[model samples]
Target: MSDKRSFIYMALVLSLITIATRATNNMVTTTLAPLGKYVFGFDNLLAGIIDAVVFLSTFISTSYINPTLQSSSRKKAFISANLIIFVLLGIFYLSNAVIIWIITGIAGIAFGLILPNLISSASLVDDKRTAERLLSLYSTSLSISLIIGPSLESYVLSMFGYKSVFLAFLPLGALAFGLSWYVKFPEVKRETHGMSAIKNKGFISSVLSITTYNVPFAALTAFLTIYAIEKFGVPKDLAYFSYIPFFTISFLTRLSMTIRPFNSLRYPLLISILITLIGLTGMVLSPSFYSFLIFMAILGIR
Candidate 1:
């Protein structure tokens, strides 16, 4: 293949791997809280703690371990990480409450390996504009997975028990494992001025914005279905459907941005913060499940 053709093929492979990895991860995350509460008889605090273990491990791995592995072959790391997750998912099917927490933490470490490599691969191109577009497409793929993952999990939950939800995503783990070999791993570059970039105001603001967004989102992912069932008497299967509109709007927003990115972040960032506040407030005051879904869509805009 020509160099350009090779790049395109690798980009496509990376996107496929991303979709499968993200979808399976989403299934696990969305399943954990309800599974803990209903299946294992965990209290709300325990379930929340179990749900949080994944993020905690991921943070440690990314912040401390990933940089040290920069000289290693990313292709090997990525494949190994996916394989670890695949095995962990199999173990999760048979896991009790205590084992589930341990598995979630290990799986998070695997994700910490996988996710940063994917982002680095997407940014391999030399041209700045092309790199941005590729990153945008990568974001779109993530949104697509977020939409599909919960929707399919909802269907599976309707037919089977919580354990089966983990089984349902096993195929996706295999798919990601298979695709991992085909991606072109980006070469590692040591950054001497990493701290300088961290000192930039743009970088600082972006970090703050992302932190603000993820805190609420993490809470929602952990508790939304439980809240719906307890508060509104939504059926267990249908309770997962509450995520549909939120993820759908998120997918649409990313798809649009990939096609035409904003020229300026100023107004869009401000508007998104405002929308998030209103959406969160509305959800608190919502009297019905349907109204809560509306606010979920609004929150997705952020």
Candidate 2:
């Protein structure tokens, strides 16, 4: 009973940390483009580049720095990463365009460290079923963050300027930092079959499928709100709401999959690809904001 109680407590802590950290991340990524364009008077291309810098730094950190720290203390790494992010959030309020780019890149490195640790912590359980459930819980937490983060930012943007979005997520970053200490990080054996795994057809296909969706998704995250404002001449707050339908539908689809996952990926993958193509086309040629949102929601079905 003690062991079960401990496991449950740890799981809850992990879920809470995931939600808080990922929500702050979502807020930053979704807001940066608009913040750059509107507040800093940047062109769309420059603003998009600023957003891309975050992911670029993240990729560098994940690929190079994270591997060196894998054998270190997960608890310490998690705490430190959260602290880095929380401090960066505070810095955003005083940042110019150049400062914003630099801060976001540093924050991305922290995220690269923190996220993999969360996944590692989730898999510490010996029970396969329990580990799978924990992984699903992690995904659901992320989906929930994606839905709520932008929606909350929209409300904040309605009353305040773009800088306020970063400050608004400060509390969440602090909460995630506080919870990082309670995380249970057990030593798990690392899998050394990466090269062999990459050779598999299933692996190749999965990579392709993920890339197909992620490419467009990443572009939209950086530019969607700006696109709405530019194309439809909507208020910044109303433009921010564009993410609501996209992320809400995404959350619902994720939750349904968690409850009843597909028996076969074949048909679902094919259908999702078709829907994505159609959604992209509709979004480009959308007659109005409502039609663009409808297509955005359609893309979320994947």
Candidate 3:
């Protein structure tokens, strides 16, 4: 294949897998509390632990495992990670509370394996403009998953059951696994040694900046529905729709950025942070559902 053809094929595969992986993750996030209570007999404390452990394992696995894998092995690594997550989802069907936590931890590790490699792979294109556009499309896939995954899982849960939800999406996992096998990863000229990224000032600042943005977003994803229900007496089904506005606006924002690449990231980044802070404050202080939804939309613009 010509380089351009190869790049297009690879980008499409990556985009599909990105959608699948993100949707799977969001499905788990959306249904986690119910899955814990109904399937695993989990109390609040234990369910929280399961959530924490997945991210803890994710941190460990990404920080340690990704640096060890060669760029050449990223394709194999991605395929292996998807296969692990696929098997883990199957395992979730048979698990009790304790076993579910273990499965979550393993799945987190698999996810850690998936993300870094996926980003690195997406960035492997020959031209900077193509790379940015490909990344933007990949990010848009994340917003698509955010919108689709929870809605689909919620519908599936209402119609079928918890176990059926996982079973229904197992095909997505299978699809990602199959597609992963055909995607080619670029070669790295030099291997990055352990923890070398920490030494770079730019890398450190970027990590800290992103971590700041994601920390609250993570909390929101995990608890927004529950908070809406408990705080404002919103119906369970109604609460689930909260993601629609947040992600829809977010998707549009990213799409705009893709079309007109930011020449000065400084002003936008500053404005995003300011808006996010205001939105978070509004979320805490707001007394009603409408107010909260407005704040969420504000944050989504970032």
Candidate 4:
């Protein structure tokens, strides 16, 4: 019982860290349009480049850093990654356009460093059911942060302005960084890798399937606030909260998955893709704010 309790505690901490890191990352996307235009005097092209560079950096970092994360001390590496993010975010607030790119790029790398360790730590639970539940809760925690983080960004932008908003969230980052040092991570196992895994058709298909679902999801997250404002003439606050339907449904869907694990992944994936297509079509043809939100909710069912 004591060991199980400790594992649960570790899972919770890992979930909290996931929330902090992802929320911080989302805050960038949420504010990207306004911040780029208002603060940096950038046009869409420049803003897109700045935003794209973060994910590009993540890709580069993941290819190299993920294996290292798998091999190293998860606790120490996780703490260090958070520290790097904390430091870079602070610098990001003080930076100009070129400098902001540099800061955000490095922050993006740190963001990439977070996930493998978090999921690996959760997987340390000995029982398969418990581990699966923790992973679901872990995903749900991310949705909660998505709901909260942009809302907080909207609030801060409304009350404090852009730079102040970044400064305001620093304390939360500090808190996550401080609390991370106390969590106990499981022992690392050496990872085996080969081209053989990639050669498997099932492996390739699974990756493509996830990417298919994720591309639209990623686009929605990155641009939803701007899309809402431009399409509906809504205030930033309203635009930010427009995502509530999508994330709320997503959280509930993931919660349901935890309670009832998928019996077969293929059929569900197909159904989800169909639903997502309907949602995308609805968004393109949406006539009102409510309709678009309804579409977003539909999309979140996946």
Regions more than 4 Å wrong, model 4: 69-75, 184-197
- What TM-score would you give candidate 4 relative to the actual structure? 0.87
- Compose the digit string of candidate 2's lDDT tens values, residues 1-302: 68788768867987899999989987888888888999999998988998898877877766566655544565677689899999999898889977887898998888887877788788888889888978888888888888778888989989999898889999999999999877767663453232455765678777878887888888998999899998999999899898888888988998898789899888888888888899889999999999998998988887
Q: Which is better, 1 or 4, measured by TM-score?
A: 1
lDDT (tens digit, per residue) of candidate 4 on 97-173:
77887777887777777656666666766788888778777788788887778677767767666676677778768
Off by over 4 Å in 3: 2-7, 37-43, 161-163, 189-195
Total colliding residue pairs, candidate 3: 0
TM-score, cand. 2: 0.93
Q: All candidates' lDDT scores?
A: 0.82, 0.84, 0.76, 0.74
Number of backbone collisions per candidate, in order?
0, 0, 0, 0
On lDDT, the candidate that comes out on top is: 2
Error of 4 at 252 (Å): 1.0
Which residue pairs overlap in candidate 2's backbone? none
> Of the candidates numbered 2 and 3, which has the greater TM-score value?
2
Which parts of model 2 are misplaced by more than 4 Å? 188-202
Q: State the number of backbone clashes in model 2.
A: 0
Query: What is the C-alpha lDDT profile of model 3 across 1-302, one tens digit per residue?
Result: 98789777877887898888888876665556656755677776665666667777877778777667776676677789999988877887777766777788888888888877677767777789888868877888778877777677757655665767777779888987887776657676665545776676577658656965788776775567667777888766566667767877888888788778899777887888888889889988889999888888888898
On the 0 to 100 scale, the lDDT of residue 18 in model 1 is 85
